[model samples]
Target: MPISHQKALPSPIRVVLLNKPFQVLCQFNDEQGRQTLADFIHEPDIYAAGRLDRDSEGLLLLTNHGPLQHRLAEPSQKMPKTYWAQVEGDITEQALQQLQHGVQLKDGLTRPAKSQKIAPPKLWERNPPVRFRQNIPTSWLSLTITEGRNRQVRRMTAAVGFPTLRLIRVQIGPWKLTSLQPGESRDISGDPQIATLLKSPKRKSYRSPRSPQR
Candidate 1:
């Protein structure tokens, strides 16, 4: 049978969903020799869709589909990702509004994004909790954006005077961090809506997606 004549699989090839834990670098290797997805995802050829900082935690998607991977990681496409941030002080309504409008960063003004205070989400225990100051208070804020600027979440919080102490990604496009706890993972069959967004043309002034650290 000709290659084009072969029957297609029942579904799109599956993508790996990893609840990337804190302190695990995004790359396969580190000069400091820390763990990475390679420690868990032994499957070959697949690459990370986007990046989650070593200090940050939560959903990180991986896949072998090149076009889909490029679309997800590409800044031009602006696929929204949601993150839950634990900051060092109470978050005010004004601060959330400022975030939604846009904030000035050293690089430039960030694009408008969504942000709101959220009740502390019940999460799996981190191996080591964030440090405490005897008098300092904290709050949780849920933020979502299409652009994945480097350290953008931390920078955005700091720009508004609430430095983030912990960050967890709760959603990527249509996929959520639901059910999959820290250090656990599952396979996503695929979603057509997300695929449509991925296939769209790259936006002007979009920063090209770089390969994940590893």
Candidate 2:
């Protein structure tokens, strides 16, 4: 049966947010060969709102709601997302300014962003802790972006000469990582505001022009 016909069935779309863990592939298949979201979310017919990279860890939204999914994932929408990054060198005032103004990349210049130095973070142990080079010092930074480009944060930090060692997304629009730990999943039925945010807007009614009477 076609998906449109299957709509008569009982299951309805719902919204979900997940804190994606490092090393897990964004997809459900293992053909290319790696752990995937299928290892976490098990609900039938559900899909992710957007994606996070396999090497990156943090807040990811998922939903069965199609319109909500399109709205969040579409590049034109430019949803805001914040990240905490640990980079390879000391964070200088000049470096912070450059990041705020936007760095040019092969794709073109990024939009202006908000950035600042942050205190060292206490995070879950990465399976293979990033390689250590004693001569180079590391510092923590907070950065936010309105666009979700491919490996964008990492590329941005590297463009500024501070290769990111650790990257964790902390916020997206109004959603937050809060208390959820990596590798864990949850159903988000408790928050009404979140529910409303995820709900699809009602479509406008249409009327046809009247035909001549016999």
Candidate 3:
């Protein structure tokens, strides 16, 4: 028998969940001297799976695995992402219904979303905190959707007549932000089931049965 060599498989992917802070860009580098992921994450090779706008805050996932990144970031995958939004008014049921049913924006009508009014979440104070309007009351909302259009969440709420004062992503697919504080991160590569979840067939929706109470 002739001797033969077999190629070894690459190491398992590394996934880092970050609690992105307000005003930090989702990218690693910037030319305008703005704050970016580089300021927080010192790890090499890992890239953000998806983006959280500079003005937005909270959970962000980074991975060194290209296929895994594509799986999570691709809009067609319909990986649900949940957010906690503080809006400009005492949100009404009609507005929540509009959000749940679908709201029309300049881009187009959004797909039906999971939307509900929630009590204000206990969170670290934001620098240059959301402007306080004594006469205008603000309300919190939990919104989940399966798309990644630019500023989609903000636009959706505005279309429903409530402008978002603050936005924080709380979950993505099977991952949760948990108790991570701003600029903190936790590596989840050791979780045995994560590979199974990532390699599973694409799902129409991947939201949790019960939303996390932050």
Candidate 4:
């Protein structure tokens, strides 16, 4: 019998997760020489699926597949992103309800979201720790929303009278920031479970689109 030759399969698309640190820019390059993604990640040809503000810290997904990146980043896809936020006030039930029901912002009324009180998440200290106010107490809340409007989370908290002191993204779609310290990165390649979740159709938003009044 003749020897059989088999071609090697190409590597599946790579998905990199980084526990983005506070004050770090989300891009690979910055003209001002500020800390950027290149300071922590050195992967070739991979780009962030979405961006994290310098003031926010936590899970940031990067990938090589353009379509997959768009699916994750596009707001229209409506993937829920979860965050643990430490707000200045001891959040009241009414405020939590307000956050859940959506508050009116300068831009417009936001879609209803999931919000609840939670114990502060265990994590590494921020390089410049959040200010501690001796007289005012702070509380933690877990907020999940399907939109990614610029500074939306901060604005939402402020609108409800509980200004966020610290915000950390804990989950996005099928990925998480658990156990990954600040500035650390992990490769979640070849995980079929996550791939399925990523490729799954977007979850329909609970709220119906407002109909125009005649």
Taking all chains together, each candidate's TM-score versus the true structure is: 0.86, 0.84, 0.89, 0.87
Ranking by TM-score: 3, 4, 1, 2
Between 2 and 3, whose lDDT is larger? 3
Q: Evaluated with lDDT, which candidate comes out highest? A: 3
Compose the digit string of candidate 1's lDDT tens values, residues 105-140. Answer: 876778888999999989888879898678999999
Clashing pairs in 3: none
- Poorest 10 consecutive residues of model 2 by lDDT? 205-214
> Candidate 1: what lDDT?
0.84
| Model 1, C-alpha of 147: deviation from truth (Å) | 0.9
| Top of the candidates by TM-score | 3
For model 4, residues 159-197, the per-residue Cα lDDT tens digits are: 999999999999998678878999899998776755786
Model 3 agreement with the true structure over 71-135: per-residue lDDT tens digits: 88877788899999999999999999999998877656788999999999999999979996889
Q: Give the TM-score of candidate 2.
A: 0.84
* C-alpha lDDT values of all predictions: 0.84, 0.80, 0.90, 0.86
Write the number of the candidate with greater lDDT, choosing between 1 and 2: 1
Candidate 2, residues 143-210, lDDT tens digits: the string is: 99877667889988999889999889988887788888897766764657556755646434321123
Ordered by lDDT, highest first, the candidates read 3, 4, 1, 2
The pairs that clash in candidate 2 are: none
Clashes of each: 2, 0, 0, 0
